[model samples]
Target: MLQIKHFSLRFSLYGKGLEQRDLEVISSLDVDIKAGELVSIIGSSGSGKSLLAHAVLGILPANAHLSGELYYQGQALTKKALEKLRGREIALIPQSVTYLDPTMKVGKQVMGVRHDAADVEAVFRRYKLPASVMDKYPFELSGGMARRILVSAAVIAGAKLIIADEPTPGLSETLAKEALAHLRELADMGCGVMLITHDITLALEVSDRISIFYSGLTLETALRRDFEDGGRSLRHPYTRALWKALPQNDFSPLPGFQPYAGTVTEQCAFFPRCTMATEECLHPIPMRDLRDGKVRCIHAA
Candidate 1:
């Protein structure tokens, strides 16, 4: 129930000697999540994944300038609209557990301003959180328990769209799978879920579609099935490279690094490292439909 079109984000910062420059962080990012669908955004640490979540929640810093359009449930997500929807119809499961209030009890925090203890208790029970854990402080809960509480808070709020940002980091493999399963369950229950993470293997397990993000741009959006057979069905070269690098695959390390944000131009960002790059790749590349998926590379066929 969310649509992001031609989205771009940049920060205006003062440079040396009274000069100002704009550092573009996200450019031409296009993604859409339908009800009961889970879309995973796979990217590296600096790919602006978390920034997109913040932008959806209207929590970006004041200096940030946003372009293009964002929509929820077929309506434009203007600043005023976001103010009305944030934390009510939309919720964020942040990257850090520190978002929990250290001073507040777990139950109260989940209840939020709604103050519906029964709702909190019901959600806690669904997640298998014991009643005693509610009275405890944040530091008293284990990592998995804390994660369940965060998910519980979103459920209690009746959020229609959940943006889970890097939810599996610092957890054991089992715990990580458990967390992802919960998100999958939510999507099955008619909630739109956006999973922003770097682990492609874990994402492939539960995602209905996968968006390959790099250097703040989405290079490809492919179905989960497209990753089969060494990603031969995948549309973008960057996506295929990622698949080959997986340990279960070729495990071949790609040369060079992703271009740093703000340094990316309209040309293909992967051109520097792409083996098939030609002088034609120096021109602007727009995302296009290809074989039931979307890819940014003009050479994709």
Candidate 2:
């Protein structure tokens, strides 16, 4: 339903009023979501996960410049096309509950001005939200309630593709799982779902495929099953490191830190911390197909 190829986002900042420099936030990002699949983008805080979300929804800041191709249903997705689809065919469940309007009642916001009351009530029931909660204002709702309400909004939008940014944050474990399950259900119903999250465990639970984002680059895109058995089938070293770091896995520690996004380099983004790095890694790395998935590392055989 959607494709983003060689996507990059750059911000122009002026240091001394006239001295301008470009800070590339997202580079060489490639993501594809099919009609009946849920793809999770897993990364740390500054890995440009949220930026990718904003870029897709055409909500990036005015100062930001984007390069790459975005497509929906095989046609070019331009700014005007995106505007037409923003809240209708493409919807967002933002990470912050503050995305909700404090002035509007929850039901009216979810169902829209011309939408049916029955649709709102049905979505509320799906999320286990009570009927009484519909009349409540955004400020009156609790965090968990608000998160569910966001889920309610996205599902009610009946969007062909849904971008859910960290939807499970701050929720109870049960609630988190329930929310992911709901997203999975959306994919099952033929709605492409792009789930942006930091919680790898939560992502593994519901995503059909997982894309690892690191330092504004996509390290790997592997199937959920590839994450099994210490990520043996996974191609990228970073992805394997992430899998082994999980409590249920090897539970080992990886040294070093993710480099800053502004740190310019020619080698692979993971080169500095990669144990298997050699002199060949000093060159720019290109994403290549490995096994059944894709990895950005050239050394992954």
Candidate 3:
């Protein structure tokens, strides 16, 4: 159970002999994860999906700045409180396992999570990881193997919520499927899972609720069935583009480029590339609660 209200993260870049320029990666974004729900966050490459995860976990970079109310299980998370809860209550599986220590054995690294022997072994086996993996170091494992290690570590920490950022990246199709299966299993066991990914296929397969984000804002949120049934019922140019880009029979790619940070005006962010753009698109778009879910675009009702 996590709630982010008006959450925003900003960064500043400095040039030689110049003052720093502010860049907003996520602007007034809000999202919630209920207990035991697996939510998939999908977006193009620069959509700030990872940034949102980092901000929630209190793992954002030093130069960056963040503001907003992040509540966990009805408790407000401040700077100090978040530090204590990050690894224990809120586990993060970063995009890459390449950062895993090469020096330590896998089991040793995992055992460092305040968990019991039985729990660790059970989770490892549930993911179909072998007992032999524990004795090996990071270099000895394959990409999929390392990903599993990270997953194991996250779940073993007794975390109430797990934030996985591109968990299936760099894996083959079969491995990706297996990894998603493992994530679903975690959700089934009462851990709220947030699977942040750019891959539409993986998102659809593993998510209960899918949230489409673009230009640091949530375009739409809907059930997995909404996506499977042609997704045409779901509107929003960016959402349409994403669904079309999926490998399907009637796919028609959306023309033009993805939205960039700070480049968007108060007008419709997708208007430049959206064929449906009209004079009414000049107004600021806000998230409206449709009967099915929430959508930001004015035309997507």
Candidate 4:
């Protein structure tokens, strides 16, 4: 239900004396979510996963400049359209609970005030929230409760595309599984869910597809099946490295650091740490369709 093509994001900074420079955080990224699918974006801390969410919701900072086309339900999803759909057709489960209003009662924030009490109560029941939570303030809710509140709001919206950014961090194991099940249920009901997270292992269980992000770009998009047997079924050097780094796999850590934005040359961003890098990797590597998915590596078949 959502498609992003050649999406890029940059931020302009003004140094001393108006000396300006741009930091490119997203570059030539592409992802698609079908009406009944849940796609997970997995990457390291600075991989621009959250930036993609802000760009889609049109909540970028004033200094942020975004390029490329974003589509929703086959229509161009412009900024104005997003403003109308953000809290209704397209909802966000933000990474930080700070997005919650400290002053407003929880029910008002979740149901948006105009919603019927019965509808609000039903959504609460589905998320296992007690009726008493409606009268509580944000401060009264624990971190796990706050996360569930975020999910409950989106479920009530009946959003076609739900961008859940790190929605299960503070949740208990049971509550975390419950949240994932809810998202999966939403997808089964024909809603497109974009689950952005750092937990590839857990994401594998709920997400239909996985898109690996590295240094501001998507290195590969693969099915959950491809993540098995030590990533033998996947492509992209970075992706395999990530799988190996997982405790369930080789437990080997990748060497070298992800370079700061704008410092990347036409050469592959994974070049410095990639043991398989060749001199031919000097040029910009375009994404290629291989097997059943896409990869941004030249050596991948």
Clashes of each: 0, 0, 0, 0
Query: lDDT by residue for model 1 over 39-146, one digit each (tens)?
Result: 999999988989999999999999999999899999999999999999999999888889999999998899889758787888899999998888999999999999
* TM-score: the better of candidates 2 and 3: 2
- Worst 10 contiguous positions by lDDT, candidate 4: 111-120
Model 3 / residue 101 / CA error / Å: 1.4
lDDT of each: 0.93, 0.90, 0.83, 0.88
The alpha-carbon lDDT assigned to residue 301 of candidate 1 equals 97
Per residue, candidate 3 scores C-alpha lDDT tens digits across 1-301 of 9988777778988977887888988876767888889999888788899998888888778889888799999989888989899889999988988768889988888878576667668878977888888889999998888989999898788888999998887799999898889889889989999999988877888789888888887778878887776776675667767787776735677767766757778887777888788899897787777756777777776
lDDT of 1 at 228: 83
Weakest ten-residue segment in model 1 by summed lDDT: 114-123
Cα error, residue 192 of model 3, in Å, equals 0.8
Residue 104 in candidate 3 has what lDDT? 93
Q: Tens digits of per-residue lDDT for model 2 on 44-147?
A: 99888999999999998888999999999998889999889998899998999889888989888898865788989998998888999989999999877888
Q: How close is candidate 2 to the true structure, as a TM-score?
A: 0.97
| Model 3 misplaced stretches (Cα beyond 4 Å) | 116-119
Give residue 23's lDDT in candidate 2 (0 to 100): 91
Best by TM-score: 1
Q: What's the C-alpha lDDT at position 132 in model 4?
A: 91
Model 4 agreement with the true structure over 1-301: per-residue lDDT tens digits: 8999889899999999989998999987899999999999987788888999988888999999988999999988887898889988999989888899999989888888558778888999987889899999999998778878898898888788999998778778777787788889889989999999998878998999999988888889999989866589889988998889889788999988988656788899899999888998988998888888999998987
Candidate 4 residue 10 C-alpha distance from true site, Å: 0.6
Q: Tell me, what's the RMSD of every candidate?
A: 1.0, 1.2, 1.6, 1.3
Query: Where's the lowest-lDDT run of ten residues in candidate 3?
Result: 246-255
